[model samples]
Target: MNKIATIDTRLWQLGIMAILLLLGVLKRDFSLLPSQIALTFISGLLTQTLFIKFLNIKKYSFLSTIITCFGLCLLLRSANLWVHPVVAYLAIASKFTLRPFGKHLFNPANLGVILGISFFPETWITSGQWGADLTTALWLIAAGFFVARNAQRLDITAYFLMCYAGIFIIIRILWYGYPLAVFFHQFQNGALLLFAFFMISDPMTIPHKRIGRFIHAILVAVLAYIWQYWLYWNQGIIWGLFFATFLVPLWNILFLAPAYQWQPLSGDSNV
Candidate 1:
């Protein structure tokens, strides 16, 4: 309820970047650092600036929380200065225009990337998960477990994972001649891991009830699988998340549900 300030949110933003930096270094991919930092900083700035200047939602704490998630993605993946900002702006606009009852109906980041990919053929593709490789994927999975556990969103996470895997397995087995190889390749993707952990589990956009979380996660996973396998959408995870975000608020509205809440992790009250 207080005005968001640089001091209040900066640490979380930095922490996200630090995690990405650590992953990048571990992968020996130093080239990604600048882009990662710039993308994250810019995305956070754009979202915060919009919220402060237009929405007047100046609670520094909430703004910082928003920044932390986006910043972490930047660290995970390098983005081009030219395109990311434009796309990110569209996302912010979507939030302001499409929101219901002062809450965005969809995840802003997902909205940006999915729309950019769908409408602008020229837009390039970049994913934070892809930057970290297998090691990052494992770390992300672990992170997802902890986050899901802390948030009490594990049912959602589990439903998401199972539904996605189920759809993928079915598609691979039926359509692809080389199910063995193609199926194995799916597991190798970093973007999928990232989505499963950080993107979909965002405490802000998802529902809190155990049943709601389960249904929401399952829906996102199913949609993601359909987008990727059946629809041949290149940005599968982005599309899945975008649609999921859009649906969550509506689901809450219709069901009169509460948004999920997580107390800070056991050791980290600061969060």
Candidate 2:
């Protein structure tokens, strides 16, 4: 592999997220406002800096902060400007405060999405913002595969997608006799793929061992299935991951493995 291929995966994640944000703004794929995006970044980065300074902590990179802000910009929208920054502040703080056994309990951005919708009436997620565009979905998958493969957490993404898809197929297609088009349409959803590849596959927040990851994936899929199909709620995958997070520490207790760390880049640029 080349230097780029061997580089830290967070860099890849940052690149992909930046691209998506740019596309969202330039192509009008989403309804993100410039002020909202600006405030989100400011709040998240400032929070990360305060924690690092106050705690005198090392072994940190701002890549995660940037990525979380991008996630907020992409997934969250608000009528009021203050909601973005408030959620960003809380989301970044969660990374510092919510560590269990040295790993953050929730993916910061995932928690941000949950907090935005649950607490703030002005904030909401428009899942269909990207539509069911085939080209966009393929682009996301191809880019996401590279990042996941580099992080060595592609297995989680695959397991989650497989479990989620199987449940969808069984319930929607076989049980309800929905057409194949409906199944295909559901699979093409950009939000679903984003949750699978980006949110659930965050190596830092999830279980450490393969078996634990496998079980986590299935549990999340089941919760998502139930939340969406049975309760008819939105952002089921986000909620599913949140609910499934309770068992992560148990799995870590049972299946011991090294906690993940972002690698130094090819040029040792991991400050």
In terms of TM-score, the best-performing candidate is 2
User: What TM-score would candidate 1 get against the native?
Assistant: 0.72
Residue-by-residue lDDT tens digits, candidate 1, 1-271: 2222213223333354466556655654444445644665576566756665775653334343354436344422333445555565566666557757655566666666666566664554554335434665676677556445544454665777788777777767665655566665676566676566656655556775666677788777777777876787666766776676656665666666655433332122111
lDDT of candidate model 2 versus the reference: 0.86
Q: Which 10-residue window in model 1 sums to the lowest lDDT?
A: 262-271
lDDT to native, each model:
0.57, 0.86
- lDDT by residue (53-110, candidate 2, tens digit) is 9988765788888888988898998899999999999999999898767667888999
Q: Which residue pairs collide in model 1, if any?
A: 2-59, 3-58, 3-60, 4-58, 4-59, 4-60, 5-60, 76-128, 77-128
Per-structure clash totals for the candidates: 9, 0
Instruction: Give the TM-score of each candidate.
Output: 0.72, 0.95
Q: For model 2, state the Cα shift of residue 267 in Å.
A: 12
